[model samples]
Target: MKDIAIVAYQQSDGVSDAGAVNEVELIMPVLDRTFEQARLDSAQDVDFVCSGSCDYLQGAAFAFVAGVDALGAVPPIKESHVEMDAAWALYESILKIRMGHADSALIYGFGKSSPGELPIVLSQQLDPYYLAPQWVDSISLAAMQARLMLDQGLITERDMAEVVSRSRRNARSNPHAQLAGDVSPEDVLAQETYLSPLRKADCCPVSDGASAVVIATVEKAKEWGLPYAIISGIDHRIETHNLGMRDLTDSVSTRTAAEHAGMHDGKVDVAELYAPFSHQEIILTRALGLGEETSINPSGGVLAGNLMMASGLSRIGEVFNRIVSGEAQRGVAHTTSGPCLQHNLVTVLEKA
Candidate 1:
């Protein structure tokens, strides 16, 4: 198979409230910056265009149609949309390249989560019969997961607090991060728990933003005369929907996806994991078997600023940035969906 590489990537500032700015407005600037980075004029420059988003955030059907407006589909460009996060859209674009459907594709994901109650909006994705009706928000489910981890001796409160502390410290250098500062675990522990066994700092802040990435065959990347990072392997796995039946303390699906993604084939110098909760970060690190050699969440991960549908793709973008900037030789990026990290997508990126 011909190697597909990311040639350019760009993202908007993650804000708590992007008041009145529609999805199209949020995506346009990101697309423009990505085009400028890849030296393309517009969406027409790519063989295909795809996107990821959730209409539930807008409380309207076909809300994603507005995203195409950012493409200026003057001549009717070939495009597609995924109801999931943009990371899945990236997966779809890779399939397009692999199947000879197109040589290059542009992928983007955006979400304006501030307008709605994000936790409640997310609850709708739960099992409709039992969970959704009870209005079990995402945070409560995560809190339950944390409780399981604590009860099973898999992790401690300090361990979770340290994750948040480190995330804030690392995010201090990320201009796009919504929450960044020199915070310590002690500082995090001092705060009152939002949910039993979980402090507000232990959870990711809801953020509104868009992210874009341009990918092409390595041949095309060289032809375009730009720096690139090869996507060596990518795979995703989903757990059964019965949340009660799964092991909340461990992310078995993440491990399965990592194995299929060939993460063991090379040393992971950096790992960009989409862990919305602090304890989940620890769970993912253990599942992937990463150690001191790996730099986890240098971009602060989701605990700094979670972009909902777009954070997954941004994880891949963060790895791409690390490779191109000579920060590392290889890395792994993980994206998740569903309650308690039930689904996972893992990608291995390497220097070109």
Candidate 2:
């Protein structure tokens, strides 16, 4: 495989609703920032372009076509799209470079989840024959998983509360985070449960936002005179769709992907995990075998702001930011999809 480096990353401020902001409006500013960071003129500067988004959120077929307007594709650039998060789009860009199809690529993801009942809207993505018919919301599915962990003695309510407390506190420093403050675990425990075993704080807020990343081969990075982070390894795995057949307390797919991504090859200084629920953070930590020496979610993870299709890419971008800032020499970024953490992607990055 050819060496790939992330040279630039940018994201919009995560908000509860980008009211009156169409998807293209939400995307253009982030893309402009990304291009500026990379010192590129526009999408035409890269050999290929790819995006990640969900048309379901837009409530129309071929809705993602409008996102291309942000790229100014009048001259026609090689481009692609994924129905999944933008992290997967990054994965695709890596393949393009490895195949010598492109030397550099631009990637972005965007979503406006406020107009619809976000959770209910996501329910339609579940198993159409079973869970979809019953309209099992995302929060409810996560609550059931949390309950299983609690009943199995794998985690405690206080343990879950502590995760939320830390996320909010850490998010205070991240300008892009939507939720941030200095709340204690005790304060969280005092709040009423929104879904039986899970408090409202335990769940990630529905957010409207966009994120963009610029990546290229090592040779291209040197030519551009840009500081970059090396993508040491990246891989993803998914479990069976049937919820009843899997173990909720453990992240089997995460562990497998971590192994494949070579996460255990060296010390991990930090981790940016896309855990939508607080308890799921604990699950991913255990699965990745991260110890006290490793810092988790310095950007507050998705608990601070869940930007649907973009948070996954943000995880990778956060790790890149840390490495470039001299805060961490090596780190991992984890992203997940599907209900109850059914699908997972793990990426390792090192300073270049």
RMSD, each candidate, Å? Answer: 0.6, 0.7
Residue-wise lDDT of candidate 1 within 1-352, one digit each (tens)?
Answer: 9899999989888999999889889999999999999999999999999899999987778878989999989999989999999999999999999999999999999999988899999999988898899999999999999999999998999999999999999999999999999999999999999998999999999999999999999999999999999999999999998988898888899999999999999899999999999999999999999999999999999999988789999999999999999999999999999999999999999999
Model 2 lDDT per residue over 208-301, tens place:
9999999999999999999899999999999998889999889999999999999999999999999999999999999999999899999999
Error of 1 at 11 (Å): 0.9
List residue ranges in candidate 2 displaced over 4 A: none
- Find the number of clashing residue pairs for candidate 1: 0
In the predicted model 1, the residue pairs found to clash are none
RMSD of 1: 0.6
TM-score of each: 0.99, 0.99
Score candidate 1 by TM-score against the native. Answer: 0.99
